[model samples]
Target chain A: MKIAIVGSGAIGLYYGALLQRNGHEVAFLMRSDLEVAKRDGVRVIRTDDEFTLDRVAAFGDSEEIGVSDLVIVSIKATANQSLPKMLDPLVDETTQLLTLQNGLGNDQFLKARFPNNKVFGGLCFVCLNRIAPAVVKNFMKGSVSIGPSDGADASEAETLVSVFSEAGVKARFEPDLLGIQWKKLVWNVPFNGLAIAAGGVCTDVIVESPELCSEAKALMEEIMAAANQFGYTFRDGFADYQIEITQPMGPYRPSSMIDFVEGRPVEVEAIWGEPLRQAKAAGVAMPKLEMLYALLKRICK
Target chain B: MKIAIVGSGAIGLYYGALLQRNGHEVAFLMRSDLEVAKRDGVRVIRTDDEFTLDRVAAFGDSEEIGVSDLVIVSIKATANQSLPKMLDPLVDETTQLLTLQNGLGNDQFLKARFPNNKVFGGLCFVCLNRIAPAVVKNFMKGSVSIGPSDGADASEAETLVSVFSEAGVKARFEPDLLGIQWKKLVWNVPFNGLAIAAGGVCTDVIVESPELCSEAKALMEEIMAAANQFGYTFRDGFADYQIEITQPMGPYRPSSMIDFVEGRPVEVEAIWGEPLRQAKAAGVAMPKLEMLYALLKRICK
Candidate 1:
C-alpha cells in the first residue's frame, strides 16, 4: 500500500515508520523540522523496539509529494484551519483521508474541505511525545479507531484496519464513529483540560485531592450528559475507564500543560471550546467543563 | 497603648513596625526570622517612605512578651490550629485579640481558645508580600475591618478603631462583623481556591476565560446563597466588589498559587472545606463552593 503521512510529528512518524518497516511503501509530507529527519532519518523508540530508517523520503512542501492510497492528517488541532491548504496536493479521488488528531471538530473540518474524499475519523489512544526532531517516544500501548465520518461505507475503515494491522498497530472499525470521537473527547475534556488548568499530573491530582477527583468526575459527567442530550449513549463507565487509564500514567503532564509551560498556542478551542459550544447549543449546562475551558482559553490567550 | 504582634510574617511585621513608628510601643512575638530584626531592627518599604527601625523589640517566646492591651494575630490560616498555645501568655483579663488572617474560622478558633477575652474579627484589604525577613513590600493600600465576632458589643470595636488609627493603619469598626467576614469569605472562597486549583494568576483565569469567570462568579453566588440560608444579609454588590477588586490586581498570583509553586501545605480546609462543611450541615447545597473545596483538598493532598 502506498501511504503518505501528513504533518509528520511523533504520531505521524510513528505510524509512517511502522508501516514502512512492514514492507509498505510510506513517505512523510512534513512542513517544519524535516531537515533533522532528512539528516538523521526517523528514529522511533518504542517499549519493545528501537529502530531508525535512514533513507525515508521527507518533504517540506506537500505539493512535492504526489497523492497516495492513504493520507493520514495528524497535525495538532490548532493547525486544522490551515489543513485544507496544506494537504491540497495530496488529495485525489481515491485517496482516503484519515484525521488522527485530538479534540472535536477536526473530522468536520476535513469533511467540509474534502466532501468526497472518503474522510474518516481516526483516534489514537496512546501516549506519544516527540522527544526531538524525528524522534518519537511511546509511553503507552493502545489501539486506534477508524470509521467513516459521514457514516456511509466501511471500505475505507477496512483498508485502514488492514494497513495498520500489517504494521503491528491494532486498528478497529466502529460504525458509530461520532460516538467513538465523543468518547475520546470525553477522556480529553476532563483529564487533559483539568490537568492543564490545574498544572499537575493526573494521578497526582486524583490522589492528592478528593475534591479534584470528584470535580474531574463531575466534568466528565457533564460532558457525558451533553453527549447524551445529543442522543449519543456512551458505554457504561466510560468516565471511570478514562480516570483509570490516566491514573497509572504517573506524574505525566498532559500536552496542554506542556503547551502552557512552553508558552505555545494550545488547542483550547478544539478540545474544550467546541464541545462547550455544542453543549450550549444543546441546552446542557456544564459548569465544571465550562470553567475548565474558560480557564484554559484565558491562559492560552 | 502597649501592643503585641503575634506571628510576624509580612503583614504582622509591616503593621507592627508602622504602629511602633507611630509611638504606640509595638512589639513582635516572632519565630526564628526575627533574630535579624532584633539585631538590625525592622525595615518597611512603603510607596511614600522607606525607613529602617533601629530599636525594635523581637521575642521568640510568647511568654517573654507578657500581657498587652491589644494583640494582633497575623498568621496564615494553617497556623490557626496552634494559635491558642501561641496566644496563651499574651491574654489577661482586659486583653483584646484581633485576628487579621485570611479564610474563615480564625475568629471561631480564637474565641474557642479564649472565651473570656474580647476577640475581634479583622480583615485586611491591603496587598503586601514579604520581600525578606522583617521587610514588607506594600503593593496596595486598603482598609481593615475590626468588629465583634458574636455581634454583641461596640466598646471593643471602638478601641480597635482608635488603636488602628493611632498606628496609621486604616481600620473600620463594623457593627456587623459577621457580615464583613462573610463578604471577605466570598472573595477568598472563589479567587483563592480557583487561583490555586488553576495554578495560574487570578487575572489570567478571569480575563482569559469567561467560563472560568462565570464559574468563579457562580461559586461566589453559591457562597452568598449559603449565607442567605443562614439568615445573613450580605451588602448589595459584594460579589461585584470582589470582581472589581480582584481584576485590577493584574496577573498577581495569590498565596495559594505560591503554596502550590513552592510545594508548601495549603490552607484549603480552612478556606473552602470548613465553609462547605458548614453549608452542608445547614442543608444548603453550595455546589460551586463544594466543588471548589473538593478540588482544592484533592490537589493539596
Candidate 2:
C-alpha cells in the first residue's frame, strides 16, 4: 500500500518511517526538512530502538506524492488552514484520510474538506518530538487510538487500526470518535494547557506542585463531566489514572508547551477551544475548561 | 498622632509622606530603604504633585519607631510571617492598627495577633510603585476604602477615614470590612490575578485582548457571585465599572504583576487564595476564581 504523509513533523515522520520500514511505500510531504529528508531520508529514535528509513520517497510538493491508498494528516491544528491545498493533491475519492492530529475538529475538518473520502482520526498515545529537521525522537511509545469520523463505517476504523498494527504500532479501534477524543482531552486539556499556562514548565513541575496537581485533576474531572454530558462517560478513577500515568513522564515537555516555548504556533483552538465550544453547546458547564481555554487563547497565541 | 509606617514599601511611603506633610509626626520602619530614606527622606511623585520629606524619621528596627497612635501596615501579604515581630514595637492597646495590604486575610491575621488592639483594613484603589529605595510613583490616585475588622467599632473606621482625609489622601469609611474586601476583590481577583497569570501582563494588555478582557469580566462576575453568597451584594454593572476603570490605566502593572516581574513575593494567598477559601467556605461557586487561584499559586510563587 502507498501512504502519503502530510504535515510531516515528528508524528508524521515517526509513523511514516515505521510504515515504510514495514515494507509499505511511504512518501513524506516535507517543508523545512525537505532537503535533509531528500538527502538522507528520515530518522526515528526511541529509548531502546532507533531506525533510519534511507532513500524513502520525500516530496517538497504534495502533488509529487500524488494520490495513494492512504493520506495521513499530522499538521498542528494552528496550521490547519493549509490542509485543503496540501491534502488536495494527494487525496482521491477512494483514498482514506487518517488525521493523526491532536485535539478535536481535525477529522471533522478533513471530512468537510473531502466529503467523499473516508475520514478517520488517530490519537497517538505516545510522546514524540522532532529534535531536528528530518530527525524524530520517541521518549515513550503507546498505542494509537483510531476512530471513524461521523458517518464513516466502524469497520473502517478497524481496518486503519490493523494498518497501524501491521506497521508495528499497537493500534485499537474506538467506535466513538468523540469519546476517544474526549478521553485524550482528559489528559491533553490539563497537562498540555498547564504546561504552557504555568509559564512553560514540564510534567514534573506540574505533578510535584500540590496546587497544580489538584488543578490538573480538577481540569480532568471537568473534561470528564463534559464528556459524560455528551454520552462519553469514563470509568471511575479516570482522573487518577491520567495523573498516575503522567507521573513517569518526569520533566517531559508536552507538545503544546514545546510549541509555546519554542515560539511556534500552538493548536490552541482545536485542543482547547473546540472542546469547550462543543461542551457549552451541549449545555454542559465547563467553567475550569473555559477558564483554561481563555488563558491558553491569550498566552499560547 | 505619631504614626509609624510598618512594611514601608510604596503604599507605606506615599501615605506616610502625606501624613508627615500634614503636620503629623511620621516614622517609617525600613528594610533596604533605611539608609537612603534616612539621608534623603522619602520622595512621593504623582502626575501633578511631587514632594520630598527633607527630614523624615527612618528606622532600621521597628523598636526605634516605638509606640504610635496609628501603625499603618503596607507589606506584601506574602511576608505576613514577620507581622508579629514588625508590628509588636509600634502597635499597642491604643495604637490603632491599620493594614493597607491587598486581599482578604491581613486584617484578620493582624486582629488575631493583637487581640487587645483595634484593627482596620484599607483597600487602596490607587496605582503606586516603589520606583527606588525611597521613591514612590503614583500613576493614578483614588480613595482608600477604610473599614474596621471584626469586633472593632464602626467609630474606629470613621476616625481612620478622617485621619487619611486630613492627610490629603482620599478616604471613605466602609462599615463592613469583609464587604469592602470582596468589593475590592471584584477587581483584584481578575485584574491583579490575570496580570500575573497571563504571563506578567499589564492592565492594558489584559484589557486589549478580547478573550482576556472577557475573561477579566468573567472573573469579576464569579467574585461578585461569591460575594453575594456572603451577603455582600454590589449594584448591577459593577463588573463593567471595574473594567471601565481599568481601561484608562494603560499598561499599568497591578502590584501583583509588578511583584511577579520584579521577582518579589506576590500576595497570591492574600489576593486569590484567601478569597477563594472564604467563598468556598460560604458554599459559593467561583470556578473561574478557583482556577485563577490555582494558576497564581503555581506561577506567582
Model 2 regions more than 4 Å off? none
lDDT of 2 by residue, A117-221 (tens): 899998999998899989999988898999899889898789889888998999999988888898999999999999988888999998888878888998998
Clashes of each: 8, 0
> What lDDT does the true structure give each of the candidates?
0.78, 0.88
The prediction achieving the highest DockQ against the true structure is 2
For model 1, residues A85-143, the per-residue Cα lDDT tens digits are 77888888888888888877888888888888788888888887778889988878688
Clashing pairs in 1: A208-B298, A208-B301, A209-B298, A210-B298, A211-B294, A211-B295, A212-B295, A298-B208
Candidate 2 lDDT over residue span B147-227, tens digit each: 889999899789989988998889999988888888998888899898888888888988888878888998888888888
Chain B fold agreement for model 2, TM-score:
0.97
Model 2 RMSD in angstroms = 2.2
Clashes of 2: 0
TM-scores of chain A, one for each prediction: 0.94, 0.98
Candidate 2 docking quality: incorrect, acceptable, medium or high: medium
